[model samples]
Target: MKRNLLFSCLIIVCSSVQAIPISLEYQGFYQRLKQVNKGHYSQVELVFSVPNKEKCRIQSGNISTEKESFPLIITKEQRLFLPFDEKLKSDRALINLDIQGETKHCNIAMQVRAKQTKMEYTHGDIVEIQAEMNAMLSEMQGFPMRYFTTDIAGVSFLFEADSDVTVNIDGVVQSVSGKLRLSRAQILTLTNLKLSLKPKVISPWTNGD
Candidate 1:
């Protein structure tokens, strides 16, 4: 996860701060830093503040880049995943947080640890991937089988900015020697499966089943 995971937070100051739940402090936030052959903009959680529910209610939100703006809905928990980009800081992108109320006191946290990614996964990681796919399958009704067979066969994963990336299972260990040096696209697909992508549909003439 050397150049892969980037946790870039831009914080603004207000008044004094309050305490946050100790458990939420260790959560990870990821954004692709270097140029990857294939990738998508990752949505990383940003906590505006641990606000008093009575005081702060986000009515609406959005993010603006040089080209476009996308809706950023804040959850009732006061946390929302922002569309993260390595260039967002330099692009001077704007984030609009519309709050019905405000909290003067909030908590600020800082921590550091070695980053992790999907390629270096264990059995537990596979469970995490399974949960993600299950959520997708539940949301996108009537999806074509071809879309899932690829992952089921361990064949390939789709990338938004580039093409589908395939990995050699045998070579990752003994199957494909030196194949560990996968391109960025392949790496990203293995890691960021939570991305909300437009599901591909089966062709009318093709046997989707």
Candidate 2:
């Protein structure tokens, strides 16, 4: 029983450490919003002013759109989720939050984003992806615009190919194919990952983020 209890504790600790907490009130730039979307989940980037950790601490929150209610995830970066059908087609995104402290001025832009399907990669698209990735990384360098949450996995782009093709990042091809996830790690180690693949592997073959 003691061993079982210890194992449970370890699980909780490990989960807490791995899953980046979601923010209820923190705002992010349009370019800064990117994450690995899995089954039944598609997220939208709500442009919000950069939140200061010293001022903002989310107590609870939720969003109502198209008559569907999405509870704000205060404990995971997959904070606000919408159905795959409603992914980029939200007619409304009304958020209500209870913040621990008062925020001075959080100018949330009430604008919707243009619709985009899942990114597809082909033989010739490597250069394009690389260019966009580099541009995103460059812009993000000045403003590490995460929600001031616990951790950031960096900008993730989900790639699907017409045929099977291995994923290559920074000139290194990963074994991942068909469905791929390319992410920039937030730390010194640039962790390339195939997040959706059942046997998720963190490839340590890229430079720092």
Candidate 3:
């Protein structure tokens, strides 16, 4: 992922923004470093001290400039991998973390990777898109968060977040990908209808299907 992924997290909200408690340790020594990209640039090896005594690392480098554009690789166990750009390409990017009300902004120097172009998707018609998505999720139970569907005709969803989700468009299902996202109001409405799933001690090892 591009280093700007972390930078994009720095959105400027008019109102106070709350911050997530993502523990970032700035005092640890990196344990390893290697070049994983095809290009040549400086690389940094990041090391972390996990609560369980387990360690993880993320390999990062740059292309031509000294700036590193790769986002920190975060393991599933909550270890934050931070990279320092040796060239310092961009020093003006600000990151804003909004959680409940408190907001904070910091200037972090970084670099971005070059963009590779491929065939793009033209904005599809919204009315038809909604119809297709509702039909696909018609039999789906529980509050759907976000998932991919390669069964649609020819349509493929890039990255579907908690918002910016409508219905699905059908055509060639070859590599068609789709995602399902619900809104706050929609969740509340689903709850009012007595269709909410209470949280439980679900085990990841067991499949609930």
TM-score of each: 0.30, 0.29, 0.19
Per-candidate clash tally: 4, 1, 17
Against the true structure, candidate 2 has what lDDT? 0.32
By TM-score, rank the candidates, best first.
1, 2, 3
Top candidate, metric TM-score:
1
Candidate with maximal lDDT? 1
Give the alpha carbon lDDT tens digit for every residue of 87-144 in model 3. Answer: 2214422211112332233212221211221222223322233234333322221222
- Write model 2 residue lDDT over 1-209, tens digit each, in one string: 11100110110111121213333322222223443122111222222322332334455566655567666454432133323334423444545655443344222222111123233334233333333333433333444332111222333332344345454443455564544433333223433322333312111112323
Which of the two, 2 or 3, has more lDDT? 2
**Residue 98 error for model 2, in Å?**
1.7
Question: What global local distance difference test value does model 1 have?
Answer: 0.33
Q: Which model, 2 or 3, shows the larger TM-score? A: 2
Q: How would the candidate models be sorted by lDDT, starting from the highest?
A: 1, 2, 3
TM value for model 3: 0.19
Q: What overall lDDT goes with each candidate model?
A: 0.33, 0.32, 0.25
Give candidate 3 misplaced runs (Cα > 4 Å). 1-23, 26-34, 37-83, 86-117, 120-175, 179-209
